[model samples]
Each structure stands twice: as C-alpha cells, then as structure tokens.
Target: MTRYHPFLVFLHWLLALMIIGGLIMGGNVLAETPNDDPFKLVALRMHMAMGILILALMVIRLVVRLVTTKPPHADIGNARVNKLGTAAHWLFYVVVIAMCASGLAIANMAGLPAIVFGGSGAPLPSDFSAFPPRMAHGALATVLTLLILGHVGAGLWHQFVTKDGLFGRMWFGKRS
Candidate 1:
C-alpha cells in the first residue's frame, strides 16, 4: 500500500496540534478566567488568534489535498467501515470550518474588543446568551470535541483490533 505524502503528514500533525491547542486555550479563556479578570480579554485574544490560524491552515490543507495524490483506502473486508472512515474524515473538516466561522461571528458581534490586543478595556456584553453566534460557537465546539474523541478511538481500533496496518499510512517516513 502507498503511504501518505510527506507534506500531507506534516499538515496533518501541524493542524492537529494547532486545533488541540486552540481548544485548550479556548476552554481556559471561557471556563477558567472570571469575567471580571483583567486577563480575560488577553486570553480571548490569544484564542482568537489561534482560531484564525487554524482556519488559514485548514484552508491550505484542503487545497493541498485537492492537488495531491492521496493513498488508496484500505480494503478492510468491510465496505461499511471504509465508508464510515471516509465520512468521519469529511466530518472533521466540516466541524472545523463551522467552528471557525461561528467563532468569527461571535468576535464580530462583540465588536472585536480592543482590550484583547492590549488596548484600553471595552465593556463586554453582560449576557453572552444574547449573542446567537456565541451559542452556535459553544454548540459546535462540543460537537467537535465529541468528533475528535471518536476519530481517535477509530484510529486506535484500526491500529490494534483491525491490525490492518492502516495506522502506518499516516505515520511519518517510509513503510518498512
């Protein structure tokens, strides 16, 4: 079986790290920082930056995927599994795009607080629920987290239970 291209592998791992980091930062900014905390805006800004980077990288990754030759899917003796894997991959892209869009909408609706960038503080909305984008962003994030867990579990299952060497397809370097 053919292995994934090196650039594709790089993009995969890079985006994975960025996405996970963004998620962690977002959680900290949203849950850990009190609304009254001076640093809350700073955290929000950082998360926003991370989200933008993810969006840019994801766009580039999609373009690369479109132009490059992808390895063939494994014939794991089950057409249903192959279809599920394909659908899951697409789901990841969809969720990421949705998350970024909603996040941007939230920032826009909130007027992109200048305080997030070290400027004088601007008052945030006292009620986040008043912003429809905030609600969508939160809901999408929850779905993304669940999808990530399912993706990881599927990878592990392929690596161990299936033993089809499918995991090696995404690993770095040449297959032995």
Candidate 2:
C-alpha cells in the first residue's frame, strides 16, 4: 500500500491533537493551579477524562496498526537514521502508554477518582509532588514532547529536503 489505512491515519491525527492538548493542559493549566483552587478540580476532571480517552484510543490504534496493511517503512539513504525513525515511531507508543499509566497511578494513589470524578468531597492533597508517580508523569511528558518535535522535524525533512513523500504516507489518501 502506498498510504496508511484510512482508519490509522484518522487515529494518528486525532491522537496527535489530543496528546498535544493534554500536555498543554497538564503542564500549564493544571500545574500552575494550586490544589486548593476550586478551578483546579474542574481542570483535573477534564484532564483526567481526556487522558483516559487518549489511552483507550491509543490501545485501539496499536491494535489496528498491528492488523492492518501499511506502506513500507521510509528510507532516507542512511541506515542508522532509518532505524532511529523506526525506533522513534515505536517509542511514541511506549512513552504515551507509560505517561497515561503514570497519570492513572497518581490519580489512584492520591484518591483523585473519589475527589475529582466520584465527587466524594474529599480535599485534594496539598501537593502532588509527594506522589512518586507525579515525577514520572512529568518526565514522561517531557520525553513525549521531545519525541513529537523530532517526529515533526523528521517528517518535514522528508517532505522538504528529501522530497520522499513520506509525510503523505500518514495523511489522508487512497491506500494503494
């Protein structure tokens, strides 16, 4: 096939927007808002819900990817660079899944489900830093951000510099 399955393409773009938005919401809005702030609860509710949805979509995307026919991997005339590209694609899945898992860990450990979702009326912890998973969540977010930048850079390079049409493979088009 000359292009990715349409469903996979749709998932790729959908997840891209969700992941980027989630990172911004988590890193900026949620991070700056103190746990005591009433708005923090609202932001937490939305952020947690989005994270859960992203996790579900990612799992489905992975399964669809494994089962679908896809174009051959792109080559940019360097074996190491090609392998790095392959590894980075796989790493996206690993880092994103781990990021979601760490977020879930923090929520469960901090009793966030009861507070944020269940409306149990329990107060949020004075600080999330006390939770070990919070640290991992932040670190994974940084990694995921870097990976995204690199992926975009590589795609641009392939499209503009190499002129290999690699970017089009992941975009909407006829599969053949």
**Which candidate number maximizes lDDT?**
2
Error of 2 at 44 (Å): 0.4
What does the lDDT come to for candidate 1?
0.80
Each prediction's Cα lDDT score? Answer: 0.80, 0.95
Report the lDDT tens digits of candidate 2 across residue range 35-147.
Answer: 99999999999999999999999999999999999998887788998899899999999999999999999999999999999999989999899999999999999999999
Best-fitting candidate, scored by TM-score: 2
lDDT of 1 at 59: 88
CA deviation > 4 Å runs, candidate 2: none
Screening candidate 2 with a backbone cut-off below 3 angstroms (N, C-alpha, C), the clashing residue pairs are none
Q: Residue 90 of candidate 2: its Cα lDDT?
A: 99
The reply for model 1, stretches above 4 Å from the true place, is: 118-120
